[model samples]
Target: MDASFDALLDEAAGAPVDGWDFSWLDGRATEQRPSWGYQRLLGERLSAATAALDLQTGGGEVLAGAGPKNFPPTLAATEGWPPNAARATRLLHPLGAALVTHQQGTQLPFCDGAFDLVTSRHPIAVQWPEIARVLTPGGSYFAQHVGGRSNVELTAYFLGPFEVGDSREPEVESAQARAAGLEIVQCRNERLRLEFFDVGAVVWFLRKVVWAVPDFTVERYRERLRELHDHIAREGAFVSTTSRTLIEARKPAP
Candidate 1:
């Protein structure tokens, strides 16, 4: 209803949605970080491994940020989107990390036992059998995944009530990994706090993370967005919960 809210909506709507960077929302939104420090742990594992693969490496930002010393002798990253793949190549090539583009939710483009350390951050979908097939014996798969019902509050706000069930739950994933012949090493999950200070941040988030509200569009949710804007104007910020899961699994030695 206010000029500020309308301006934010227009600005965020026109903002580039390329790459995995969320720095644009820096001062406008906040999320509590997982205590395990995923990048730090991933760096440690990569430094100790001979070869490594990073799955769903959006723009290779996280992988590249892990530092040169943290990288293994052979490092490869896979991205599904074209824009992200190009960006990833630009960022990762200088670091000697090869970038491979493949369709998401499909089989990875790598040989069996191709990597000893496989990592991913917020992978859209985990093909357990394919992951196990590509990992070397005794190799490990480590990742921080979006846990069950992540950002559901935000989705419910726009799309109304929806069933999430146990999808992406750590326990269920651990069981599936074991079924795929990977031994679970560690499993941890937590619910983090999230806050959005403006409607622009919400628009940008929904646009980038399409899965949050599958068919989210400004035209479709304009009324809801306006209501949320009014609520945030009165409440200072819109708060929500985000769930995260960290899992480590190892393949059995031959």
Candidate 2:
């Protein structure tokens, strides 16, 4: 409603949200990193892998962060969004990695037992059977999944109270992996702190991470955004929790 709110909303709305890079939120927001250091661990795995695949590789940023030197001889990634797919192609091709534009929840285009290592960071959906089908015998799937109810406080603020389902729970996913004939090697879940310093950060976040408020829009949630802006002005920052799960599963050797 106010000039500040309008300016913030316009800035966030107009800013580029094409890639997975969140550098735009540098000072506006902060999120605690997972203790396990997923990138470091992924680098270790990539260094040892003969063939590897990264699913839902948004912008291929994380995979690229693993360092080109650590990349396996055969490295490939899949992304569904065309903008992100193009971004990934530019970032990965020079690193000797192939990028494929593949739809989420659909069967992966790779052949059976094609890769020795599979990885993803915050994949929208995990196709367990497809993951198993693509992994070689004794190969592993290591990923950091978005846990159930992640950032519920932020979502609830905009959408009001809602059912917190078991969609991305580690236990539920592990069971699915087992049913898919993959042995759960390790699973860990952690809740991390997230802080939005201003309303613009919230706007940008909701715009980028569309799942947070499924139907979020500046016009649609203008009143709610104004209220949140006022609250942040008074409180200095709005805090929430982010849930993450690190899972490692392996196919049977036989």
Candidate 3:
């Protein structure tokens, strides 16, 4: 309603939401980190592997941060989103990792037993069979997944109460991986704290993470936004929980 709010909204809406980067929301929002330390674990795994594939590597940010020294001699990454694919190329090419753009949920373009390690962080959707197919016997798949009903409070605010379904449930994912012949070695789930200080941060987050509230538009949800804005203004921040799952599966060795 005020100039500050309007300016913040316009800035968030117009800002580039490319890649998986969230630098813009550094001071406007915050999220508690998972205790398992995914990036640290990934770096350790990458250090030991001879060949590896990173699925849905958003801008190769995590991989690049892990440093080239940790990477295997043969490294490849795939991104489904175009903007991320290009950004990944720019960040990973010099690090000797080839970036490939492929449609999510489709067959992966790699030979059977092509990689010794496969990793992904918050992939849009996991193709269990493909992961098993590309991994050699005894190879491992490590990932941190966005679990079911993550940040549902935020969704409930905009849209009325609705079921999120079991699509991203850990049990469902574990069963699928097992059916694909991958042995579930480790599975951990956690719900972390999330805080949004203003309506602009919420707008930017919804736009960037499109799956959060599909078809979200400020114009369509102006009234709800105003209400949430007022609530945050009065309460200081809007708090919610975000669910995440850490899974490590390995192909059985014959």
Location of the lowest summed lDDT over 10 successive residues in candidate 2? 1-10
Return the lDDT, model 2, position 73.
93
Error of 2 at 222 (Å): 0.6
Candidate that would win on TM-score: 2
Cα-based lDDT for every prediction? 0.93, 0.95, 0.93
For candidate 1, what is the total of clashing residue pairs?
0
Model 2 quality (TM-score): 0.99
How many angstroms is residue 69 displaced in model 1 relative to the true structure, after the best TM-score fit? Answer: 1.7
lDDT by residue (53-86, candidate 2, tens digit) is: 9999999999999979899899999999999999
* Model 1 misplacement above 4 A: none
Better model by TM-score: candidate 1 vs candidate 2: 2
TM-score of model 1 (CA atoms): 0.98
TM-score of each: 0.98, 0.99, 0.98
List model 3 lDDT by residue over 1-254, tens digit each: 48877887788889999988899899999999999899999999999999999999998998898769899999999998888899999999999999988899889999999999999999989999999999999999999999988989998888889987998889999999999999999999998999999999999999998888897998898778888888999999999889899999999999
lDDT of 1 by residue, 1-254 (tens): 47898899999999998888999999999999999999899889999999999999998888988867788889999998999999999999999999998897778889999999899999999989999999999999999999998998998998889988796998899999999999999999999999999999999999999999989999899989999998899999999999899999999998
